[model samples]
Target: MDSEVRSYRTGGDEVVLDLTRDAADFVSGRGDGLLQVFVPHATAGIAVIETGAGSDDDLLAALGDLLPADDRWRHRHGSAGHGRSHVMPAIVPPHCTVPVLGGTLALGTWQSICLVDLNVDNAERQVRWSFLAA
Candidate 1:
C-alpha cells in the first residue's frame, strides 16, 4: 500500500490523477488482485473515466449542477463556503478497486483515474492507494 497527497488550488475543479502504478506495488508484481483507490476526505471523490473529449469539463459541469457551490450548506457554518461538496462525496464511492493481471491495472485503453475536488480551498488531499494481490 502507498499513499500520496494531491493538492488542489481551486474550488469546483477537476483534475486527472494518473495511477499507472496502482497495481505494480502489490508486492508480487504478478497476480489476481484488487486495486483500491481511496480519497480520504469529505469533499472529494475518485473516478475512473476517459481522459479526453471534454470529459473532465463535462464532469465538472455536472457536479456543479448537482451540487452547486453557490448554495449555502450547513457546513458553511465553518470557514468553507460550500457544503454540497461534502454531500456529493457521500454518494460517490471514494474507494475504487480494479482487477489486476500481470501486475497492471487492467483498465480500458483510454480509461484513466481521476480525482474531483469540490472544496473551496487550496490544500493537500490524501489519496490512499492499496492493492490486494491474490
Candidate 2:
C-alpha cells in the first residue's frame, strides 16, 4: 500500500474544495489499484459531486436543511450548533474509495472528489490518500 497525507486550510466557512486533481496526481503513472480518500476529522466529510455546476451548492443547501446549524444539538461546545458539524460525517461520510484504472480515477465525467467542510470552529484539515495495487 502506498499513501500520502496533505493538509489544507479551509478558513472559517463552509466549502466544497475540489480534490480530483490531487487524487489524479497521487496515482499518476500507476497501474490498476484502489484509491482511498479519507478525511481525518470529526466535523468534516468527503463527497463526490458535480462542482462548478451548482451541484456543490445544492449539496450544502440540502445538508443545511437536514442538519441545521442551530442551538439544538446536545453536544454543544464550540459555536452554537457546532455539534451539527460532528453529525455531518454520518450523513456525508469521511472517506471514499475510488477505482483507479491505468493511473486514472474512474469517476464519472461530471463527478469530482471534494472535501465537505462545514466546521467553522476548525479551519485546518488533513486528507489522506492511500493506494493499493490490484
lDDT of 2 by residue, 1-93 (tens): 999999989999889999999999999888999999999899999999899989999999999999999999999998877989999999999
Q: What value of lDDT does candidate 1 attain over all alpha carbons?
A: 0.66
Report how far off residue 114 is in candidate 1 (Å): 0.9
Query: Pairing residues by index, what is the TM-score of model 1?
Result: 0.77
- Per residue, candidate 1 scores C-alpha lDDT tens digits across 1-134 of 44444443444334445454443454246566677778878877887877677887777778778777664777774335467767877655677777877777788887777777766563557777676656
Query: Which prediction has the highest lDDT against the true structure?
Result: 2
Once all C-alphas are superposed, what RMSD does model 1 give against the true structure?
Answer: 3.4
Error of 1 at 27 (Å): 8.0
- Pick by TM-score: which candidate is best? 2
Off by over 4 Å in 2: none
In model 1, which residue pairs have backbone atoms overlapping below 3 Å?
Answer: none
Worst 10 residues of 1 by lDDT: 5-14
